[model samples]
Target chain A: MSETIMLLCAIAGTYLWRALGVAFSARIEPDGALFRWVSCVSYAMLAALISRMTVLPLGSLAETPMSFRLGAMAVAIAVFLLARRGMFSGVIAGVGTFIALVAFA
Target chain B: MGQPNHPPGGRMTARAVVRLGLRRGVGLPSVIVMTSMMGFGSLAADGGISFLTALSASALVWGLPGQVAMAELWAAGANLLTVVLAASLANARFMPMAMSLFPLMRGGTRHRGAPYLLVQLLSVNTWAACQEIFPAIPLHLRVVYYTAFASTILVAGQIGTGLGFFAVAFLPKPVTLGLIFLNPCYFALLFAGTRVRPYVAALLLGAFFGPIIYALAPEWSLLLTGFVAGSAAFFFFDVRPTSVSNAESK
Candidate 1:
């Protein structure tokens, strides 16, 4: 029962912003002040979420050592930088590093 | 504005455009969507989230950060309000994304043809790739091209989530564990890929604040960090107009 409501709420919240965008499309500038601020907020939110998941995960991920996790992040960033900014390249590199560290060390 | 790769008179057929949209969507865009959804599926399984709940999120919510936040917060026993707020905050970037892409897509007339539903297909990658190529497309075909592209990505995304949900049974523990890292790694990569100064500033500040605030108050961390860091980045952009214009000109 509660799960259903939460799902609806989540969907509504996400669509609200998008619908608002459509409504105000003509007036809004992508790089304008409000957009920029909103962009910043969303980026910040995502960054915070990513860091939280890595540093303070709740499940199987928490079983892995911090060193392995941190090492994976470093390798991933390096690959991302070197591989023409590809997301899959970075993620694959990170996951591979994590698995390798766990297996070898 | 960037010049179109093809001339205006060159009519892009719906079939040809759909083929083109699918082909371009095949590589990084689909991979990112598939892998991220896969990670979400695995995470959902680990958290003991129901198949229906997780799949609904993939099909409906679509935004990974929001889906992940909802799952994590729910697992942490957060109330409905917290879950919604966190999820919404994570997905709020869609506004700017839609704003930028709408004007670029032919008329961009608001509420035209049930845009609310159409925007559901507007994954970040679809928007990015479309911006680069849509200008080359004839105005009449722009909507067809975007719809085809977005829907194709959506299909791949849904399939990926379903696979992830079931893969848990056959997949190795190490593989399952590794999948969870894919979403964050990709998200971080996406952040790094953005050269825009405000995004960079917000990212750095957000990274700095995430852990600090988590230690202080886990529940409020996302909201507080986002508001403070994002506002700070906005100010950073505002204060550095000269450099911004220089970068813009270049």
Candidate 2:
């Protein structure tokens, strides 16, 4: 089917970069300026993803008010910082806050 | 270079190697990976993908986000080429990641073939953990140690997917939501907590720009936001080399 072909194509296209990265591993140094730039870009892109999911959410979370979402994120940030900015603590705080806010509202 | 970077003999027992891997990765991070994969596998199953197919995808593709996008797009009836294109874009992030970790693990007599085999196991979770632990591991054992760790996570992920696939009937709404949420939550916290300051800056700027871009153009927002926000951080780092060197020094 066309769908199957598409899936295979997607998988191959994605793998191309992974394969390329491996092939050129020696040539690309992470500490160099170019790597640093890409790292920055990668980081920003990741950040955008997280923010989009929480702030501009889609599907189910969209029904949950934006203010509530911001509050959950704020509380999570607070917890993350309070726990010396540990990731586990931040995730717990954010999810916990969202669940509690939903329950109370 | 004298003893080679990985295990000198390349003959360590599989059990010892696996133990080293587990010891290296046993923590909240690995737990996060397992849980996220479980949720991902379950969602795929719920959407009507076969259990074998889901596991095979994980085994073959290995990048969960790419796999998820591929399956979701497929289910939504996107053209095959488009699905593949989108999946490749989603996975473009991994190129740098693999580039970062490979050198640290390559041995003096580095079997080029080994890394290719290991590439199948290369995901963000494993890469991050390897970066943190690679320096501390004895040079000679680094390969076996990392290979063990990578394989364990791979097996654990497969098992998690199997569970997700089979447990579709009984999963509750709260849990399903939790599973979907696992993907983003782990990503945000992990990025936010990294010592990579430029990346952190990227996240901050990208977060701000993502919605703005999305509002302007819904379909292309992800690509546009990534390029725009990433370019911003890239230019900033280019101009401010001192900031990066200072952070590295500390």
Candidate 3:
């Protein structure tokens, strides 16, 4: 079936790089050119995806008002800054704010 | 009773090291991933995906955005090829994540398939946590800790997926909204709190350009935005004279 095939492809595509990284693990220096490119691309790609998701998400998230999303993100940002990049603390704050906004507002 | 030839100060046994890794990972990092992954499961369920599909995707893919993309695209009735392409593109960052972390790990290549198995456990959360923990541990225990910690998180993720699929199935619009924001919020926080120069630059430029380009060309926006913003950041850092930074040794 198409569904099975799609899932297989998805799994393979995602795992390929991870497998390749293992294969070439000790050979690559973190600051080398290829590593730099991978690093830059990774950071850039993640940033773009995160920003886009926050700014313009899909599915049920698209249903929520952008104001609520922005407010939640602001709270998260404040928490992240205050906690000095403690990731869970920031996410916790954002989730709490987002729930409160959605429930009460 | 067993010694594994630890580095100069490796005072703990491998079992102790593994326990420490699992204990630390089970706390904050595991909780963060569970919430996000549980949300993904709920999202997938809400999108009409079957339980099996959702579970396999999370266990196999292990990336929130890619899982979301796959679920959403599948819901939209996208072709098989489109689904694979989009999902893989979303997963591209894991390559760098794996690459950067492997060199920092210790003795993972000692056994057959150990390195590959270790990489399988290395999510963004685990990778970040390892970077924080690896520098402090002796070389001998580093591999043990890394494996235990990452696998704990991954196991937690699988359980969360099941919880989201069955227990918290079809989350109400409000909680769904909140759960969806957690992953990106985590990353945005990382961006805001980053100390590295090029990464900070890339985050800024990527944030600036992501939405504009998404509107302009949604299909290729991720690749285009990353390539442009990342390249610009790389050049900005590379071309600058390192009198203050590079000239001095670490």
Each candidate: how many clashes? 0, 7, 0
Q: Model 3 over residues A2-102: C-alpha lDDT tens digits?
A: 77788889989888878876666567654455566556766787788888898888666887788988889899888877988777788888889998988
Report the Cα lDDT for candidate 3: 0.77
What local lDDT score does residue B128 receive in model 1, on the 0 to 100 scale? Answer: 60
Candidate 2 per-residue lDDT over residues A1-105, each given as its tens digit: 554555467667767877776786766554566556555655665666667767766444466788877787777677777899777888777777666666666
**Model 1 score (lDDT):** 0.76
TM-score of the A chain in candidate 1: the value is 0.69
Give the chain A TM-score for each candidate.
0.69, 0.75, 0.76
Q: Quantify all predictions' global Cα lDDT against the true fold.
A: 0.76, 0.68, 0.77
Best model number under TM-score: 3
**lDDT preference between candidates 1 and 3, better one:** 3
Model 1 spans > 4 angstroms off: A24-26, A30-42, A86-88, B1-4, B7-17, B73-86, B99-103, B109-113, B127-145, B217-220, B238-250
Across B83-116, the per-residue lDDT of candidate 1 in tens digits comes to 9987887676677567666755645334566666
Higher-lDDT candidate of 2 and 3: 3
True contacts kept of 1: 0.67
Candidate 3 Cα errors over 4 Å, as ranges:
A23-26, A31-37, A83-89, B1-13, B111-113, B168-170, B238-250
Question: What DockQ number belongs to candidate 2?
Answer: 0.48
Worst 10 residues of 3 chain B by lDDT: B241-250
